[model samples]
Target: MSINKTNRSSLRYQSIKNDGYIMERLEELAKQNPVEGFWKCYGRIRNSGTIVNHKKLHRLYKKMGLPLRRKIKKRLPARVKEPLAVPAYFTQTWSIDFYE
Candidate 1:
């Protein structure tokens, strides 16, 4: 999900200008109080009626060389296959394939 680029630019700069100090302070608080998720921190700031744009915020994070923590993808556990013994020292062997 994403906001339109024009909308983001319009809102982001306006938000920065209107609440630059608050945005900066939020950054400081994020540093000092280190939240587990950066997006969550952004949400907190958004709740403050500030105009901070996600694209701009992300751009700054990129500029500062900060890594965004990606959520680990959940995977189903692998199914365990039972071992089978085949008899074929010198004898002919037959194999079969079945479709489900």
Candidate 2:
């Protein structure tokens, strides 16, 4: 089966319209919840009575560049290297042994 050019163009137009509406909704959700990730946005949309497929939603989510930035872990300051303290006399150190 083959589709004529007009029909193909019409279908494309309809798809574009639908995509535009979904994109707008996604953008609005993103704006309202800037820190929320894609799944949260998808859940909000789903809870709003819109039955969008997760795959499609993910595609649009990625297409709109709406992925949340990952938080970086804070690094602790470097410690000063110090020489290990050694007992001058063997009697100064104590050793413990454990037995089961």
Candidate 3:
């Protein structure tokens, strides 16, 4: 009860300092793309030759309130209208003009 192997196994050395460079880079990217979430940012960092842990980026992303993507509305297609052939003379045009 006083001591256990499980507790001993869980213990591990932790880094005393975090690289401010990664944090600063992440913040800058987030500013540029406010909706970019952890995974995307992590991918960018990796692509840029930075190997920061994803979990750390996730925590920081949440802390900074950045999301993966924004909800953008899809653009609607325009309606196509056919050109009307107007008759120059009133007698030339005839219809069951119920609407008019």
Which candidate achieves the best TM-score against the true structure? Answer: 2
Candidate 1 segments whose C-alpha is farther than 4 A from its true place: 1-23, 32-35, 69-80, 83-100
Model 2, poorest ten-residue lDDT window? 8-17
Q: Candidate 2, 34: how far from true, in Å?
A: 0.8
Model 3 weakest 10-residue run by lDDT: 1-10
Predicted candidate 1 versus true structure: per-residue lDDT over 7-33, tens digit per residue: 544565443244456557556756866
Superposition-based RMSD of candidate 2 using all C-alpha atoms, in angstroms: 5.8
Query: CA shift at 5, candidate 1, in angstroms?
Result: 34
lDDT of each: 0.64, 0.87, 0.77
Better of 2 and 3 by lDDT: 2
- Per candidate, the number of residue pairs that clash is 0, 0, 0
Better of 2 and 3 by TM-score: 2
Q: Roughly what TM-score does model 1 have, to 2 decimal places?
A: 0.42
- lDDT for model 3, please: 0.77
- Report clash pairs, candidate 2: none
Alpha-carbon lDDT of model 1: 0.64
lDDT of 2 by residue, 19-40 (tens): 8878999999999989899999
For candidate 3, report its TM-score: 0.47
lDDT of 3 by residue, 1-100 (tens): 1365456535767667676787788888888887666777789999999877788878777676666666699999998988999889999987785773
Steric clash pairs (candidate 3):
none
lDDT of model 3, residue 58:
80
